[model samples]
Target: MGLEPDNMSGSSPEDIVNAVFGHFDPKNPLTFKDEQFNSDPILSEKALCLVYILGADTIQFTDDRLIEKLQTVRQRISEKEIPQVIVMTKVDEACSLVRNDLRKIYSSKKIKDKMQECSDLVGVPLSYIYPVKNYHEEIDTKNDIDVLVLRALTHIVKIANDKLLRSDFNKEQPLTYKDQHYSCDPELSDQSFCLVYVIDANIVQYTDDRLIDKLKILCQRKGKTDP
Candidate 1:
């Protein structure tokens, strides 16, 4: 999501934060979409993960108000179990060691300190923060820069997959089968599921009772075999 210019001044931190996360709140629903107001409902529900792009060189000069808003956003996303990552760009401009030798990113104390500062400010873990050089002057893509970006993307996809697997409308309710209820399994993660039943649309209403019973039996067997 893009933030309006500071001169616009009409959008408050609370407004922006609410527009993003409030859609998931059943108590207070945003019923309308306003481009001028920068409001889009159901943003949180549609987004698989949140990615915060920060300039590594100017992180120290980040505005206090923006930081506070981000902290609140982080808290809400954490409560919902959505993954958030920070891509700290312009790493070369942030540290001289990394600028001279891209391989020294890990060993560069300055880069590490900047990453830690970002984590402390945004409430995001250090592991989820990636420092990389944004392609500004380079006419060609560099392997070192691509590596850092790819690593962050890989982590984001993995965590997002975990969230998707755990997501279900009935997750809060107990698993029930034929009046039998079972507690939701908390250990479920990285699981895959695919169960499809297709019948001719024209004949769907005329499906035999015996066929329906067979389908139910198949569903029960599939559930039993699922890990």
Candidate 2:
């Protein structure tokens, strides 16, 4: 689901909010539904992740109003624990080194700092943010451009896939660790155990030895100790 460029840059807050929440066109009765806007995982079909695309060159040019809009969306999405990623597009325009050669993106400290800035602004971790150059002026598709774009997309897909797999396991059986009742469903338990290690390590903030021991015990009780 792509948003119009104006929705992020020039639109009023109210309009931006409406666009994020999604609006129904009266003329198109068949397409008029709130599902497009709804972020609820249970209500919506496969709400795996939310990707926020920000132009590399526009970050400094963005006004407070736009930042407020982004914050509002970030807060709402965070509440749901939905994985968020910032696609920092147009790195070529932002850094001269990258503009000369896309392969220099990772080695360029300037690009790294720009990515960090985006991460800090969006309140997402640096690992989740991806920097990529858009093929704006290229007459022919370049391998370097493709590689950068593909790398960003690959990360996004992997994160989304992990979320979907976890969600599916959750649906089969909820893994509630509070009351000593780990999921009785063996498949669910196994998947949850795998997820505990597979999901972004940053997501699991509490990783003390005691907590690890408890989880290991829980897995053992479920007959799968390997995590």
Candidate 3:
């Protein structure tokens, strides 16, 4: 599922990547659900504020504010169990904010003037963010909007397929490590495991070679490891 819409800017990277179909509706602007946007335990009010700035009726999605939003998005992504793809649209306009050189947007003289404030807001490297625009062209009977959408979808699939995950432990009994939980069905179906780590919960991570042995010892002492 996606996080939020970027209003004038378009969908976020995470939204773009996660969406199976449909991009943000330019007509209907809205923010992310408070429950999901506030998912990260370490996320501060500033993070929410950055998102608010990006998707608000005002703020114009400046590079500085955009960078801060991207950083918060990255932090939110890291906290999630899945990798995310962010797509910031209407970037054709942001190009005007750059200096004449334009070798890199952030390196441009205008953007450089606000570097300190931008960095303070967004704790992410500039290299990771990508800016793009989708303008409907009438000059060509067969325009490339569909192609761009297809390309975006293909890229999202690639990212989803390339996500880094914990090594499969299919053969072994699922263990309690980090926030991973394990429970058996009385009907004897396959076990279920939910590992929503990187967020706060009353979960445990006691499972190194030594720690596993120690836990086994204690479980056995209390008769919690039989069967």
RMSD of each: 14.5, 6.5, 13.4
State every prediction's TM-score relative to the real structure.
0.63, 0.66, 0.31
For model 3, what is the C-alpha lDDT against the true structure?
A: 0.40
lDDT by residue (tens digit), candidate 3, 93-145: 44564322223543444343333333344442333223333454436533234
Query: For residues 100-202, what per-residue lDDT tens digits would candidate 2 score against the true structure?
Result: 8778889988888888778877788999988887876779998988887899899999998887666545544555766355655567545643444464578
Give the number of the best model, judged by lDDT: 1
How many steric overlaps are in each model, in order? Answer: 0, 0, 6
CA RMSD (A), model 1: 14.5
Q: Report the lDDT tens digits of candidate 1 across residue range 145-166.
A: 8998888888889877876666
> Model 3 off-target regions past 4 Å?
1-76, 96-127, 136-153, 164-227
TM-score of predicted model 2? 0.66
TM-score, candidate number 1 = 0.63
Q: What is the lDDT of every predicted structure here?
A: 0.74, 0.69, 0.40
Clashing pairs in 2: none
